[model samples]
Target: MTDNLGRGASWQAQSSQSWLTVTASGVAGGPMQIQADPSALATNTIHYATVSVKSSDSGVSAAQPVVVALWKGTESVREVATTAAVASRYTRLLADPVRPYAYAHSNSGMVADPVRPHVQLYSNSGTIDVYNIYTGALVKSMSAPGSTLGKMLASPDGAYLYAHDLAGRQLKVFDLREGQVVATWPLDASLSVFEGGLIDLIYARPNGVGVLVVSTGQVFRASDGKLLATKIAQMPNTDRLVHGLQPFRGLSSSYLAASLDGMRVFSTDSRLYMVPNTPFYWDMDYTETNEGTLSVTKAYAANLGTTLDAGLSQAGGIAMSRDGSRVLMLSAVAGISLWSPADLSKDRMLAQDLGLQSDTLNVTPDGNIVVAGSTFGQGSPQFHVLSPDGRLLKTQVTRIAASTVKPGSTGTISALTADMAVSADGNVAIQSAIHDVDTNFGYLLTFAPIRP
Candidate 1:
């Protein structure tokens, strides 16, 4: 990274998870440093470095800055301040290979962390405050990764987080216990690795065999970052943002459900092929018997008061019922289209069109019901309740207009675009916003499904 500025000055800081913040500017031929947050002093540290650069004139921004860091698993050793700055350890992690595939798995399957309250963030940039099951207030805040971090796989125990760093062409693993990085791996982007730095995660198959990491068109085993197969979902001529994680419990066999932009479900026989477009999306888990097959018999996203899509115009988000028998459609302008999982041709419409709209959708694990952000017509969308078949169970305008969408790319969620996930028991349903807004600080905050 270079600019017209030739000579430069930069500093590097150290901590469990190190970061660099521009501290002092314009040199005064004197001492200029940064102080650590007094509150974080005990938990974190304040490491600073100052460099003496030879410049024709005293111009800060006119000069370039450099930084280097180090990340190693050791004591809470605060880095000794240095006169010469270093870079972030992650910058050098690639030199090693065995540790790159580490990832922090959640308490459940390799899906988004419910401990997270937002919709769009990965566990690294996790905007979650995991609390003790007994007392819920504040635990440590695990942030999302670089917002661009993609292709994550959790350890079989759901304790470690392994994410492919598309930006750096490397794999980063973190220890959830300490919320710190512990391993790194380098990839050959020139090989089965896809282009455009587009990588996403499918569930780990066989529990321990390995999780699938899909990028552009290539797939790899998340466990070893080894290339598995390429171009599984060979969909051409369309740019789709997929939302898939190992279904809460669909890891028994080699089965993985791939959702295309909240629409279309493609069940693969080693690749992403069109299976069926239905009324609901399969969000939670349902383990099959010893025969090695899980049946789709339920719905997760609700449609009652929320408008769903059977057509393109009203298109919004599409999900399968937990049982995989129905489809739950969230419409942009109208009602939801309840389609059969077996045949997209068959459909049912519930809840009249027009009234309001919201971006996020909340779904239960069993596919029995759902909830949506409150947005009655043109005003900010709020929360509403619905039956799996698209009935107006309830309207919650005053309840959740401020819902935030999930933006897990960072350690926080701030998008207002709302999304949902189910807990392990298929009982607790969590709805969150993908995008965020300050006006609605904690909309929905995190929903706990009311008992039947």
Candidate 2:
């Protein structure tokens, strides 16, 4: 119960059912506690009761209805029975692609193609596939040169798909609508050294300037990928290179998210960087001594004027609303935090007492709603939707794993099965699982709006 009264106000809680008990006789401008006897609940039925509150200042009284829902074993809560609907479900992702590693951990494997009615998935075998998500029909497929694919990013206009080559030295641009290869750009020779793993991708076009953010840092480019500039590199201590941010490996590290306007980019490590710099390049020196190991000293680079540290120890996910007014950040210990893009200094922690670790976060295009996927094992899997001010509007438990249904069950659920995506309309949500290295498979779930 919340206290909304001004000045000093005393209130008492009363209930008609003996199963409900009030822990305190009265409360003044604070929370009122209530206890329930779970053993007294009737099986397979929803218990209802009315709680009345009386104010000491006046004779005004108010009563609210409460509900307690109980279920039997082997039965599940059906969304259709309530006000929600399940729009789509793909049971096994590994069987269809025929590539076990395709469903493996990817910073960005599945993304809604900027074009309407189509979604893209990577096979990591030099193949890019597009399908109609609503119908589950393959629309098109194109093959590049390498079986080891990096991040797959679509152009802002949905005309082309940009990805790193197998060697991780060059960038390949595939024309999605035209169905052909348009251009391939190569990086500096020093960067050609084989760095195995997924590379983060962020495609942003704010105002009229287009920029691409990858593992190496921000790259400024035109819509056609012709005019390019290396704004930031990995090792150099140049004016544009950012310092104090450590690069990590676990799929989620080194992630990037651009504002709706594309003027700024946010990293998974709780740092924001400005994009669109002048075309220039610089390299740092690395020497191999008799020990056969490379040695180099770090240098302090010039700090960019536009940078904000949100104070997250390790940010797992970051997202910005379509209007670029609000931001959502998710970390292991801090739960979820919301910040105002206009002034990030003014921020608030949302659902801190949830007692669940979140793996991913997404906000609606309009900046009105935010959703987060919880860690699988630490607690029951759930998706939390909240308003801009951190008010929780809904908590939808995604699933009950086999292990949880019956301890010591046959199959175990991966704690990394939590991934979320919100549609542009803000009415539909698609939740899926990504292989967490040890597991070789994943599943997908979709939710449509009946009413919010």
Candidate 3:
């Protein structure tokens, strides 16, 4: 504490709450120490207290009040259940925003329907199989020829299923309720250059679906397969002097994420790009002939080496909190860092020096907890649950007993290919352990009531 008038006066501090104690009171213009005892605090509650400092000098008019807040997080979660082993491992997992259901996408070409809380959709060749998500019971089967269900995304209302047809180089929209392919639009010709390369697609709210390949971004109407806006990376004028007027097309290999409101799209190479003015165009009707290029605002350099290159080939290393308050980037070199989506400002580091390799990143819908999975050079897989401001709440390691390990295996767990998801209410978290070599079987592990 410092005195306002530069007068070094003796000051005494008092705490409003019993849990908060002032360790040392000193003269103004010096330092004082205070501590908080949360042992007796209730879980999942935020407690506030004030420390009033009164100076002995009469020149100081009023007592200066310092506010302190303490939050007692929910109790740590313990492993509750594990699903039966299956031949096909799920490479992708997601939790529904409004339902108590989890979607698991198997490597054998099965994807859970995001709209239907209890239904799973599997596409083998041209046949679509619908099954119950929980019971593994077959609901119905339908066939749609010439459609490949590679990398599917559901519309906000769950009315349409947007899928990429790699073989045909087209984007197909399937009506979930009708169980039929309603529309098919050819992808941008420029995307063909990335033929076998990484391409990302995300469903933005307010009826916009963004397709990002490297630095090129295209927005389409979710209601129909109409191309709305196309944006190319615009290097700064300083960079143009060195590289000429050519557009910087290769910003990132594949990292892509959008905000909850669908107003902005984020992509990163070494630097972060918040594609500006996305909602303005999508909110209006712009035909292919009338469509114009979306403006580029600014690009922020995160200074983290190879931001999302390591262990992020199949899984997205970039994610936005459900509340759209924070944008998270998982780096193998720098751990997990949080940024403000509003301005692309570095907020703070949530966790650092995670390991040699870190991959999966996710945030609860309420934006309170963040979960990430990492591995230490073929060691047992570990997952960390953390608060928004960098507090390590819990860490769990997946270990298999030596007797349970598969023969000829090293018994080490790898999270390089793992995927994780936390429920909307922050009560449940699920992780897919398909790449665990010790257990040749693929399965889902569940951690329930993770938050109060």
Highest-TM-score candidate: 3
- lDDT by residue for model 3 (1-452), tens: 65544567788889999999994468865778888899999975546677887766777654546656554655444443333444554444544333333444442223334434222333335444443333333445445576544555555444565556655657667676676778887765555534323455676642222332222355665655555555544332223211122222343344567766455656544222222101001122222344433333444333222233221222236777765777776665456666777655566665665542333565654465455555543364556777666677876554433223244535432332255555444655455453455355555333334543
TM-score of each: 0.43, 0.53, 0.58
Model 2 / residue 208 / CA error / Å:
1.1
The C-alpha RMSD of each candidate to the native structure, in angstroms, is 21.9, 19.2, 14.8
**Stretches of model 1 off by over 4 angstroms after superposition:** 1-136, 143-157, 160-166, 169-178, 182-200, 204-210, 213-215, 235-316, 327-331, 338-346, 349-359, 377-380, 397-452
The digit string of per-residue lDDT tens for model 1 on 1-452 reads: 11123333332222322233334344333333433233322322212222322333434332322222122222432111111111211110000011111112121112333222111123333222332111112234445456335444444333455565655566666665566666665554554334323333454332213334443333445445554544333322222222331211111111233332222332211212221222222322222245222222232321222121223233344455665665555554555555555444436665544333332344554454444443443343344556666666654322222212223322222212134333332333333322233433332223333344
Instruction: Supply the global lDDT for candidate 3.
Output: 0.49
**Which pairs clash (backbone N, Cα, C closer than 3 Å) in model 2?**
206-261
lDDT of 2 by residue, 179-294 (tens): 66678866443433333343456766533245565655436363545434343434323444224433222122245666554555554431232221111112222112342211
In order, the Cα lDDT scores of the candidates are 0.34, 0.44, 0.49
**Which scores greater on lDDT, model 2 or model 3?**
3
Q: What lDDT does candidate 1 reach at residue 177?
A: 50
Give the higher-TM-score candidate: 2 or 3.
Answer: 3
Error of 2 at 442 (Å): 8.4
